[model samples]
Target: MDDLIVKTVTKLIIPFIQLYGIFVILHGHLSPGGGFAGGAIIGASFILLTLAFGIEYTKSILSAKVTERVEIGGVIWYIFIGLIGIAISGVFLGNRVAGFPMGTFGSVISGGMISLITIGIGLKVASTMISLFHHIIEED
Candidate 1:
């Protein structure tokens, strides 16, 4: 972890990895990858950071409190979105029937609530991964 090359590489690559993860989460409705995949990618970046830097440094960036909040917030957001569907269409994740505007075909906003759902899932997964990793490290 004291290697200069690793630290430099991690610092440079983490942003791009996170960006790609966001892209996957956003475009999941239109493409193959979805929230889980995107979240895993982002989580891997954090893990890499922990490896290159240290647990204390990683904790400084993403404290336990913040990670817990993000994990809870992701679930709450997902549930809120589902509730919107139920309120509108009497179904838990009703998309078109919920009166959500489906954008033009093959576009980013074309999947109605799907994109939103994936966003929540992505956040949850990423935060969960980070939390789990930290916990494991602490145990060791």
Candidate 2:
């Protein structure tokens, strides 16, 4: 049954995928993965959850409206943070001028802007994907 497929995928794949997404978000500053990749992975996780749990369960976790707000708010938060760099650092997204103490490479919270942006992007992406799921599954 489709339900079994969805449930199994949700239970098994989501955790690892989400962990990988977090890794992507966290490792962004040191390596290739960044906000975009992290965000996308979070989004994928949500989609899988929705498919497995069904609309009602999904809504329990995140309503479509809430997801929309989260997406918008994340973007706003990201913009605001980036703007701080602009006003002080003299360039957009210029986090360096803000004087964030860059920690050891590959450590969580090591890269300041990279971490902040990754969080913002993850929320934005998760919410966006949830919204998309609501649009598709809510009708069913």
Tens digits of per-residue lDDT, candidate 2, 1-140, equal 25776677569877899899988887777788887888888888877776667677778877777888888999899899878887887778876678767888666768667788778887787677768767876673
User: What 10-residue stretch in candidate 2 is worst by lDDT?
Assistant: 1-10
lDDT of 1 at 21: 96
- The root-mean-square deviation over C-alpha atoms between each candidate and the true structure, in angstroms, is 1.0, 2.4
> What would the TM-score be for candidate 2 when compared with the true structure?
0.80
Q: Write the per-residue lDDT of candidate 1 for residues 39-109, one digit (tens) a residue.
A: 99999999999999999999999999999999999999999988999999999988999998889999887
Off by over 4 Å in 2: none
Clashes of each: 0, 0
Error (Å) of candidate 2 at residue 96 is 1.6
Instruction: Judging by TM-score against the true structure, name the best candidate.
Output: 1
- Candidate 2, residue 84: lDDT: 87
